[model samples]
Target: MNKIKKIGIIGAGNMGEALISGFLKSKIFSPQDVYASEIIEKRRKYITDNYHIESFDDTKKLVERSDLIIISVKPHNVKDVLESIRDNITPEKILVSIAAGIKLDFIRKNLPEGIPIIRVMPNIACFVREGMIAICPSDNTPKEKLEAVKEVLSILGRTIILDEKYFDAVTGLVGSGPAYIYLIIEALSDAGVRLGLPRDIAITLSAQTILGAGKMVLEINEHPAKLKDMVVTPGGTTIEGLLEMERGRVRATIIDAVIKATERAKELSKA
Candidate 1:
């Protein structure tokens, strides 16, 4: 029989809850194999009641028992969380952090030298198991542990292993990119409404269109420009809309937004 991996999660916020949901649904880990540390009494009750996993108010106790620990707290709370569990971290354990702007060195400075660490950027889409997760593992992280994380995170859609140097940019493009797509979706829905469609129908059409277009880009494996060309015929309605978008420099503006967000991510780490 295969050995079941024991996992512990620190923090019970949205991201933490998403991971628990993802982990359990994957069936890679069982309820008894998972533990959650939540300071809030209400959240502690919620996790135990809903998921039937062991929930604790003390993070250190959770760290001592689990084989793998996922630090899912916010960026600002990372240092505090690290300090709380650093003494308990063992060489055999793998610590995965989902907090943005917290670097591997920052985590290493707080913990014992050579403690295995993996940093991942997971977006809100993880709640729906359609997230684009970017992972950057430290030199000390074992291959087996990295593979374990990969298998578990597969429940939350596609996962990519990226250079730590590009993490901030990756966070900007995919981590924060969902909000940008949402804006476009809302605008498209508004356009449909302006054309006399009911609000619900407009929203459904706009959302499904984005979903279909995303699938095409992933499945077709053609240059986006080439795909856009396929949609335009001689001189058509699509061309007119494309010209308007170009005139407004919509593409360029979005590109600049990614750069700006990346810069901001770096800025957060400085303080």
Candidate 2:
């Protein structure tokens, strides 16, 4: 519950590495204050050599030394990681998990009684420090501790505190959202290429257009429909493109994609 002086990450994958990178880049914690546990020798060596942080093959050792622990392993590996470090978890230490489909209750059941658990769902965008992260804390998590975690998460991107009940929806919307956006960008680039534009230029234009549109939504604080209306002059090219998109049921397809992904997330939680 005290200020986090030392942090340990349980995985060395992209998300784990991203957090480490963000933390160091933000100067919230120094490399010596951060530690990571990776099973692979090469990964451990790489993290230590590149980041100058302590790396270990033993999860228990990292848990023992860290004031806060972040579990960034895959969804299926969460329970095993919890079990391995269960005894090391104490009331004084806060635990955070970024694994999708893993719930706070599941983590609590795996750990010692009354251990504070925080569930986080961060998108792939976190790798670039432009992510949208959702955090859900267990009933036992102290307000101060949760705020401390939020401060650390802010370095990665925007952070929102939400009810655990909405996590599946968040998982679908933001967790899987990047892949959907990437697909849209790819399709737009392909369409440009088909229209005789250079492939590289098409990709750059497509990506930047999506980026600008997103920035407008965030900065203008207006409904996206209003923005679309502003772009559609009567009998214009934009309207023709909009009509084609409507004919293809693009909106419905995207909605279905999120729904289907949410359903799969629920299934994974049960598994």
Candidate 3:
């Protein structure tokens, strides 16, 4: 990451701008080290005004100037963006695609052979630097280059390296994971409100509880079941609630959610 100087993002939409935000928040890369290309003038202005990073409308120029280029455009727009910038990509430069369902081979076909490419699945939590990112690099990607990418990504949150085969699962688990958690939080908040808590207090308590539970699982170095046991005293109030949730099949439904989402991602990839 220290060796790589400029990071360019094409398509300064939500995810593209989020990457820029993450880069700046990381403190490893300053605004000067970031560049972007956005078709939308408003978004371009937003990037410069908010982050103080230079942005352009010319994709090729962005590629030519950047050390590592991230393709953050929509999946349907990937081919055109690649075609527009492919010639500018050199062997020493790294190209990363964060668009969901956009495969490495799909990106490779439009670029010169031996140009290293990386595919990443990152969630919305990236905006807050608490993201879960899954990275899969093309075979041509050098080991040292991959390490640099990992180092750069660490600021955003935890990263996992998996075979591209598991990316759809990653998408379901971590990429779309935040939305699932939000749904649970909402449900909990609503339950609190039903139990006579004020809306504002209910929401805050629900959110904090979720956040605290997640931190405990992560920081405690123990399995979640053991943690659950620590909370669920024998024949207590917690057990009664757990039994009710079990009766409602909540656990299986959550598992099915990820599975169903993964299947949908696989379908989208084929499309």
Candidate 4:
């Protein structure tokens, strides 16, 4: 049996709904086991209608009903959400915050003492149960409690344990990584269209190519550089594209993008 019998999501926005979708899809929990609270009637209705889960605008009631509460609201709205239901959150309940840039200490400060809070950085892929989730628990969070969070997260995707210090980078790299890949996909689709492929075919080809390449890298268990060499046969057309990418500084630019996003997350933490 799952330790998490009832789970409540405080915000039924994109990430929250995605979590709900992935969780139910995993069959680790059923619709009756899920709960959500969304201020937006349309989003709340969507969750209830599609997932058939109970949801309301009352965060306090949601907290009361759920033993495992997920704070999935936006970073800017985190403080307000915490404030509204801090008293209802007891030590027994495990609070998991998925709002990027929010630290364990900040959530700890907002809640009563002894609340086992876990900070998780989950990517957009959680919508499809293929996310890479990074988890860091607060000081003194019980080993079993941490494990419980991990168990819940495992259904969504891979979970890695790390120090809280690395969370901002995880937020930048994984939490925001999907968007970068999406941009790449979009560019590839456009490039295909420019090369005379139909738009729909271009999109499918671009998406599938990226997906296949990523799957190869994972399943092959070889260094990415080695994998790249495999694709770049002697004097092949791939080398021309690789050379152009080198000239365009694609590698360095991606590095810079992650760094910039990490810095921004740190800034948000301070705010």
Candidate 5:
């Protein structure tokens, strides 16, 4: 395995900060082993004071110094960032990007030929080390580099190595799925509060219920319909509630959201 001595993360936004936190908590890389570049002074100061990592305002300089470079900037600005560091990229360094809509080919063509590139899509849960991250390496990448990428991603939540063809769907189902669940949690908590439960208690119960239910599906490995049948008894309260959900078309709406989001992700790639 190749030793990743130093890692550079461009863009000090939420994703970048989350990656830094996971790296420290997992103890995979020390503060000195990480470097960050942020245009904002406040973000720069936060990383410097909190993690003690070297900070840079120049993206190209950061890429030159680190063995692994993570591009965490917005999709629209990915072109700009790649152009800035295109000349600095070398075959020895690995470039990993978390920007959606920026494909592996774009990164490969914009940078030096044969430079190792890994395109990833990770959610905000990574900050707490429970994130689901997708890793799709460029075809030119060697097995050794792919393994290294997997090791780093394991620090977050579950890491899956997938073909680039499924990236957009992955982005829809997992990447944007959190926000959908968050909305559901909030609505459930609000309903509890309307029934006279304390606000904090309602929120706590709602969150735990969702978490436990999610764990059940994963651990039991049963079809969701079978699980739903187990909960709905003949003329019981669960059946009554489920009937209301069916009447409201909740399932259909949720399914549509994932489909729409997946389509949008595909559209982004085109642009």
Candidate 6:
């Protein structure tokens, strides 16, 4: 597909602002090429003043002016926004929806027939540009268009093209995964504090350790179990900690968390 010269975002919330920030910071699109539509006057003003991009209260106007339109509004608001822009959306404009639990077929049914639609599940980490994103395109979307969306998302972090069927699991894993990891970090910090470490130092060390371990898994491209074994020496403190965690069924609990979250995602999609 041809280069996407302009982008319109339908929300000015955290994720929407993150995309605008990512696009500008990556130099993929200049401020002039980006526009946002936000309902609140304060939010629109903030986007305009801070990002130096055009902001509107009218979704139709944003869609009319943009080449690529990102539906960044909450899932419940998606239908209304699509209804408002249905007349303005044409074959040339690419539509990408980042609203959680909103499927590609649902978007297709709401929009003009054969309008290219791409569904994306991106985590909150996007604000920091360390996001994990999953994209699934409708059958009508061309390969180039899908690639273009992926190219734009790559600016935020790793992008994976997956079948839409896996999106609920993706939502459970990477989308809600950050919160689980943050909880772990907090628990580790608490453990350190109990062991007599200063609170500030303990929190720093706990956060850094988790960050380094994640980096290792990504850079080394090795199975996490093998990496765990690498750190487990005979009669070591790590082994003792691992044993305690096993006794507490931490592994099973984490797995259950993902399973429960996936079920909730499925329920939300139906709503």
lDDT over C-alpha atoms for residue 66 of model 1: 89
TM-scores for all candidates? Answer: 0.91, 0.94, 0.94, 0.97, 0.94, 0.94
Please identify model 4 stretches exceeding 4 Å from their true place.
Answer: none
Give the Cα lDDT of each candidate.
0.86, 0.91, 0.89, 0.91, 0.89, 0.91
Q: What would the per-residue lDDT of candidate 5 be over residues 110-184, giving only the tens digit for each residue?
A: 887889999999988888898999999998888898898788788888899988999998888888888999999
lDDT of 1 by residue, 1-271 (tens): 3222788999988889988887787776779889999888999999999989999998987998788799998789899998899787888888899877889888988898878899999887777788889998998887877887777777787999998999889878887889999999999999999999998999999999999988899999988899889999877899999999999999999999999999988887776
Backbone clashes in model 2: 0
Which runs of model 6 end up more than 4 angstroms from their true locations?
none
| lDDT value for model 1 | 0.86
TM-score of 1: 0.91
Writing each residue's lDDT as its tens digit, candidate 6 over 1-271 gives: 4488899999989889988888888776799999999999999999999999999999988998998899999889999999999998998889999887899989999989979999999887777788999999999998888888888888888999999999999999988999999999999999999999999999999999998999999999999999999999999889999999999999999999999999998988999
Compute the lDDT of residue 111 as modeled in candidate 5.
Answer: 83
- Tens-digit lDDT track for model 4 on 184-270? 999999999999999899999999999898899889998889989988979889999999999999999999999999999999999
Task: Give me the runs in candidate 3 sitting further than 4 Å from their true place.
Answer: none
lDDT of 2 at 179: 93
Residue-wise lDDT of candidate 2 within 1-271, one digit each (tens)?
A: 4488899999998889988887787776799899999998999999999899999998988998998899999899888898899877798899999888998888988889877789999987776678999999999998898998888788789999999999988999999999999999999999999999999999999999999999999999999999999999999889999999999999999999999999989988999
The predictions' CA RMSDs to the true structure, in order, are 2.0, 1.8, 1.5, 1.1, 1.6, 1.7
Per-prediction backbone clash count: 0, 0, 0, 0, 0, 0
Stretches of candidate 2 above 4 Å error? none
Name the better of 4 and 6 by TM-score. 4
- Residue 226, model 2, lDDT: 100
Model 3 residue 60 CA deviation (Å) reads 1.7
Instruction: Assess candidate 4 and give its TM-score to the true structure.
Output: 0.97
- Give me candidate 5's TM-score against the actual structure: 0.94
